[model samples]
Target: MLSFTRGSFSDRLFFHHHSHLRALLQYRSTQRSLSVVGLLPLSIVMSGTRSINDMLMQAARSKKGAVAAGRPPASHIAVEKGKTEKKKEQKVSAPHEKMKESGERESGRKDKSPSTLEKSAVAKINEPCEKDNGTAVQNGIEAPMEIDSTREDKENGTIEEQKDSDMGLEEAKLPDSPDIPKISEKISLPPVGVSEVPSITECVSNLTKRQLEFDPKAAAFWKKGEHVPFAFLAHAFDMISCESGRIAMTDILTNVFRTIIFTTPEDLLPTVYLTANKVAPPHHGVELGIGDATIIKTIGETFGKSDAQVKSQLKALGDLGLVAKACRVNQRLMRKPLALTCAKVLKTFKEIAKETGKNSQENRRNKIKSLLVAAMDCEPLFIVRLAQGNLRIGLAEQTVLVALAHAAVLTEKPPVAAAQLPGRLEQAAQIIKQVYSNLPDFDQIVPALLRVGIQDLSEVCHFTPGVPVGPMLAKATKSISDILDKFQDIEFTCEYKYDGERAQVHYMDNGSVEIYSRNAECTTGKFPDVAGAMTRYKKDDVKSFVLDCEIVAYDREADHILPFQILSTRARKGVTLSSIKVQVCVFAFDLLYLNGKELLQEPLRVRREYLYQSFVEVPKEFSFAKAITSTDLEEIQAFLQDAVNHSCEGLIIKTLDKEATYEPAKRSNNWLKLKKDYMDSVGDSFDLVPIGAFHGRGKRTGVYGAFLLACYDEDTEEYQSICKIGTGFSEAVLEERSASLRANVIPTPKVQGRKCCGCFVSFLFL
Candidate 1:
């Protein structure tokens, strides 16, 4: 037997060869009984197998048994050997102090004679031991050896080897082998007190409970300023889309707005516009102009697919948004894209809108592709839909306003109980809706709301001269009797409802005239003649005014008002005074603003008086709507007939006195439209075919809600889209019709002579 003390050269050599000795033992034990392998002991195995042939024989025999005995397998042994060689090379190449420190750390345990240590280790290995739980225990060490053995068993082979090794080690009663010193214990101090870091749940809870504090000076989430990720808005849209209840959608939007108000107040305007599926105010006339083909092409390019493949996927998915989401699954990028911010997205959309003239389509495609490439998660779903000019998430402009109102109130830190919160929210929502009705410009309203709070929002934003107010609507009346019965004893005026487009003409203080449609779309370019005619008709004293009127196609020589179909024939854009083929006459009715003063709060009678005094009639160029102030049924019926005779659609009976203030964006009960069509049965009917449908929302969810009806043109051999019908069907009828139409559904519209009308239909019939 060889004996040496710790730190001796021989002892160091023994320690270095320890892993090899174990490998030899593993081989011997597998080929024969443990008693036979233990006969030679660790010293003779280490000393005897010095030659190349002897070592090769030992390694070959040990290969199977080494793996079977829960030792490091051949591959693991090779890796370990490589690691050991690298460590040796580093130690040899290192500075003298580093080598010395490593040597001390490896051998720093209390010194013991090599013979004594060998005896102790041999005694521990030879003794039979009970299992500690399911693990084999050969020494004091528990976890590391057991874990390595279990891992090797899984990696190298099956559990049979592990079971045999565990049982063999437990049953074997071998003679003493040389001892191996235990690995040094790494001293890990217990963490000082509880961890200082808060959990994700705790952080979220804190944010929810924390009162909102608006700090204009505080650093924003984005580099430029306070801006939210576009993903945040997409997630909200996703949640709102999945939800069918209007109240639930409102709640989700409310929370989304709250987060934006707290973290990035500057992004609130863009967020609001995106939520409403708009890039700018309606009167701005900004449109994305991205077609389905362009969107499909952009998606295909981003995901490395053909347009046909994208179209195929779109057919399967019905929605381009879904197609985008599905295609993104396998998408790879050259580098990680910059995170999209709300302001960045709005800016991109505005850029897309500005793209026009030669190569405009290609430019738009590239911009859209960039957006798709940067989009992550459900963001692609919304980006596609937003480009299509519809979100289809059941989030109405009214609902967004309601949510915005509530979010603003909550951010103000209302000093009220939970019971009072709902009332406060409702009051704030009403105020916002009212202000938005009068102003209808988020660019003006949102900043004002955040500045003066919801209480004074109206004072800050109301009836601006350049911005068009939402036109007040009227409820349809069945007959003159219904109007008479509803307005019993209330002073009213009956005016001719001309068969023409509703126009709101704004004469600016700079002597510039602008015209807006009922939906607030700019039509100044479409009707240059009408704008010129308005200037000629206006009195010299009328400096700046907003006139609510009807622009009708009129015959100058015959002195007759043409039908609405004739007015629709005029060019919608780029029309010059010289190219005025379809001449229009403006019949001014009510004055909303005059000489920089808002008359919205004034009675209809007073506003009407202002309208008549401000502008004079110019025959076919401009005039006032013929009106009669009477309570008699016979007189009203005669006037309605006269209106019909003059190519008017019906009569607009409006309250002239009490409760008659102009209510923009409202379908007021104070005004009623007695159309000639409502007084009789179906006078005209067309055999229209259902070619396409719009997906249902709200109560009509999960079924077709509206349909695109088209009439066949025999001469063109095509189906010409006539109109879209949504109101006549009941719930049961819609489902029944949807079932029948669903079977005929095609992936895309293939009808000939169907012009690009910018209508997004959910499903198309063959």
Candidate 2:
């Protein structure tokens, strides 16, 4: 490797800012009207100037002309330029170095030697300078005057000064900012420690060399098919990583090649994590119609330059919707990002290969491959990662276990973690991991999770009763501390939070647990456990009854909450006990039907009195989530704390007056979520680590645009991009991060990725 440390090239036809113009001239000279050389037309070159610079320039011009004609450059052009640039670095210095020869020649001239004139001509270099006399002179710049009494010395000095000065004018120029600063100057990047890499060049270079070496003949197929999508994804990846365009492109080829091949070539459908950028209500009407170009312009101005050239690039990004279309985009929203992992990517590709027959090129050619709409088939490994958002050999499973720990208040008992419940999605992933460690990739994981909880049964429900829940859960709270002190005598009631469908489980004693979802639609077959559990309930007054409770995953052996995952066990029917070990536990928390009345108008206190006075209480398997009511603020605070510790979403404070009527199916003001976490934090607080980021969209693109944060992998060192977070940032965060993150630009590209030993993200397809 030729490393450039310190040196100077001799007199050579180095390219100036006028290089393209010079090349244009060379192109014009070529009778071909297309050759590009240093200011000479191909006609001139063909007639022929045999200099190497002229030849290279001519070739460059020819290539440029071809591109203008809308043709791709032949591979030969890149190879040719590579060689030319290498050679130019080694060019000889100006002939002015022979100043000593100049004097010798002059003496020879005095001696009337024949070689005198030729030698003097060779020593003469092209240079001119005015001698403080303020006049343009054709002779070289004069050296500082030195008075020499010695006659021979004075004569030799004069000749040498003239020549050497001329040579000084021809030395090669130096590069800009040679000693590249570390990305994180404040924190040194140790060999293995997460270091700030100011730029992505070195890694990108290695990637480029690898690509050049990747199956040369398949170049046509891959090149024509890959470039644009690869380019865009790489660009997005770079923005997220804070790397430059070239570096992003380089990383794409190196790290992300396999994922790209397996994903949609045009839209890159595999990467589902990059939500289309849009202005959120983070700050309502902060500004309008502002674009990244504006931010770039401002940055340019700050740098004492203009963004005229960069505006178009920013425009291209906007057109692609990689940035918001709004005029004044909120800096916080624009900076929120999503990140993916390498392992997920590998699993996605492997699944695609398997589904399409790994080596069956002929089959793939025959198939009109469209796009990957759904994630790759769920692999065991994939499931483990999908839940944890990270995939190390043992890492993903650890996440679910932690979620279990949180739900069980394991963190509070000994570790005192802020969060507990492994939420629904995390609960599912944890289940998969708990059951299997060497989980399959995403392609294998997604489907199984979908089968259990995903209900496309839109045929039954209308509105999305519960929020989309986003990609992951924020936090759930039921704290009633604030409202408890207002009431003199709070009522404490325990009703079974039934596990079966809550949508008015209407059974006319017809030997059926005809249940609907939270939304009313008779889904009788979905939960056989709920049906079986209800049959065992000692309800002599339940000839025909309706109740409300959650459908839970139960383990008959433990008769306890199965880490919120026991729900998955009862998904499909006709199962032998050993097959899935599916069981059900019913927690009937309320009742809307008894005898022959619809109690929708009944007050919570009345219903509680009826439930407590009417039903029996059992522990573990079938009972309430457990609750206590109080008028004291301390008691309410205790409830909130205990609920949070119990993996519950804070506390649910409810009015208990007998006159307080039930507001069926409404998130009314009568009940409020006094969440412990939300009371102190903004938006929802998630323990996510930054995995990817983006340049700020419109307006705020100057500083760090946005960031991609993911849940941490306790076992595997990875972050799976789940949802693109775009809210709840304080100004101080942006101000501090703006300076710090510039150092840690991902050396690997996000679009594709460089080779990674662990799991990569496959969420681009989610």
Candidate 3:
């Protein structure tokens, strides 16, 4: 037997102790003329009587509420015990019917004075009256009523009996206070010097007007402190779905953030994360682990659609989210749905994450099905997209964060003027971006900004020992000449760009090391040997530090570094020192932190000096990236070739200026990736703007077989035909490109007579 009991009423309704009594007492206190102590018993009795009558009315209306009286509880043990136990008591009294009979009590007191009648009414409060046989009377009115269990009403247990079991309870209705004057009650305005008090009608009219002013969709969930429907977010997602311009996308994102700010300010973080198309912060690793199979199964279970039917919809729509939306709109529901809240959705995702081991797959399938069933139209669409991690809504995390900063300022009390807003908004965005670059968690940042302004958030955000910070990015340049042009007169240090994985290694004070990828994912388990190497070669003076470096596979016997492919062989999990084949060397370059101090704000030159002085590099296990400091192009050219000879990619030309501070998660000209691929004369590699492509057949079917390259026509601000190259690309590259084109390419007019080697060339705009 399944227990469907949803806990107790006190757990579901009242959040605090004696809440009903407190509410009643508080209401009576507002009227001063009423005796709160005397009204306590009267209030409870009235509340109980009203509840019994309401349940009886509901039972009379629907047979769904009916439950067998002699069913003998659910389980075998309870059945045996129930046969020996005493029969439960039952009594019924209708307050309205009892009030009509009050004339008898009043007639009996007709000869008595008004004070005597009042006393008589108070005296009969606890005594049982003879009327209706078992009905108890309180103050000439019906007291607490136990529901009758007579044969006619025996088909079902009363409301109180169902409270201990499965039947859903209706909301407890409180009786209206008799003290507050009704709209029909006479009232007179006070004389001179008295303040005006609103009448009951005026108060009710104002409340209705306020409700009318609120957004209907938001107001539905606002009273319960739940998230607005996903339909609202889907509308925003639709607005920016096809938009290409940055400004236009930013405008739409800002509008969405403003809506969240105004409607559910506390939900801002979860909303931001969902809109960013992630379940949690990048560093935290909260994957939904929901595969396409899981999504299909959930949709099938939810709508009773077969796998083939779902597949047909998916193939036609080309998006799982759209498939879900279509299925949801087309299918009829089995039962009333539970409302989908942003918080509820997030919590469900967390629950899914916790389902593990043997039965985990079935557990996940059921949970996801519940979520899909509870969600409607656009809600299931977003939920499916979120699970798939393919929210194709053009806005990125940066855009969302910028909009959040703007929201914080715009939604502040005593609104900021329009003219003064731009500058403050920019400052707020920069502050938020800076904090996010270090922390990168909206769960932490959003609440801090909401609690204390941006100023405090900036000060509060810091680099923790284990959590990964976004790696600093470098701008790309074609030549040393172009790089010099950007950093004119400033001497720059050119470091060899090793063809290896970029790793950020944190050496903690507790003698533990954690390594993270450039994307801030913890890859600590994948590089246990690297951790051992760091411990062996770590500087004694450096109690704790963060090293930004490259980890390349080392050919120990040959005394040379292997390519990235060799290092890629390392396992992502369950790595052991004994089974390790490919040995790696850490090429330390920039020191972002040293000895409990963050050097991100310090000059690159200063950080490099600390890096060189603090740690001694081991030969094949660890070493600093070879560097040459010079402003001369010829010297840099020679160094770049030497790097290429050593299986390196190219040179990373970094500014040697005092203000060349490390900017995380940013691409700045201060640090440039001077790669051979960008060189125009190299011929081996050419960066051509792709403006069109020709569809393939036979071996290259269903994809754009070859791309039509172009050069910028500055005067016309358009692309001109250059050359098409299709031979070099692999099947994987062609398929990836084809998928990208199919998703992002806009339709354009065909070239009537033009062909690239007997193939039709289809042009794209962006």
**Measured by C-alpha RMSD in angstroms, how accurate is candidate 2?**
25.5
lDDT of 3 by residue, 246-312 (tens): 5666665665565566667787777787788877887776777888877887788778889888877
Candidate 2 to truth, TM: 0.29
Clash count, candidate 3: 0
Per-model lDDT: 0.68, 0.35, 0.63
Candidate rank order under TM-score: 1, 3, 2
| Residue 275 local lDDT, model 1 | 94
Candidate 3 is scored at a TM of 0.64
Q: Which candidate, 1 or 2, would have the higher lDDT against the true structure?
A: 1
Candidate 1 lDDT, tens digit per residue, 1-766? 0111222311222212223334323333442312222211111112232332232344344432121233322211100000011111111233434544554444444543232222111111111123322122322321111111111122332112122221121121222222211111111211322223432233223222222332312312233344688876776677677776777777767777777777778889999999988999988889888878789889888888899898888767778999999877655332346668888889999999999899999999888888888898888999998999878776788899998998888878555576877788889999998888888889999999889999888887888678998898888888888888898979989999988999999999988999999889999999988787767888999999998999899999899999987988888899988888887788888999999899999999999999888888887888889999998889999998998999998899899989899999788999888877888954333559998898999999999988988886643435678888999898998998999888888656664334534676656775
Model 1 scores a C-alpha lDDT of 0.68
lDDT of 2 at 456: 24
- Given candidate 1, what's the lDDT at residue 758? 64
- Model 3: runs farther than 4 Å from truth? 1-221, 224-235, 238-265, 680-766
- Alpha-carbon error at 706 in model 2, in Å? 15
lDDT by residue (tens digit), candidate 2, 646-745: 4455555556663355544344555555565677775344656665555556555555455655675543344565555546655566657666766555
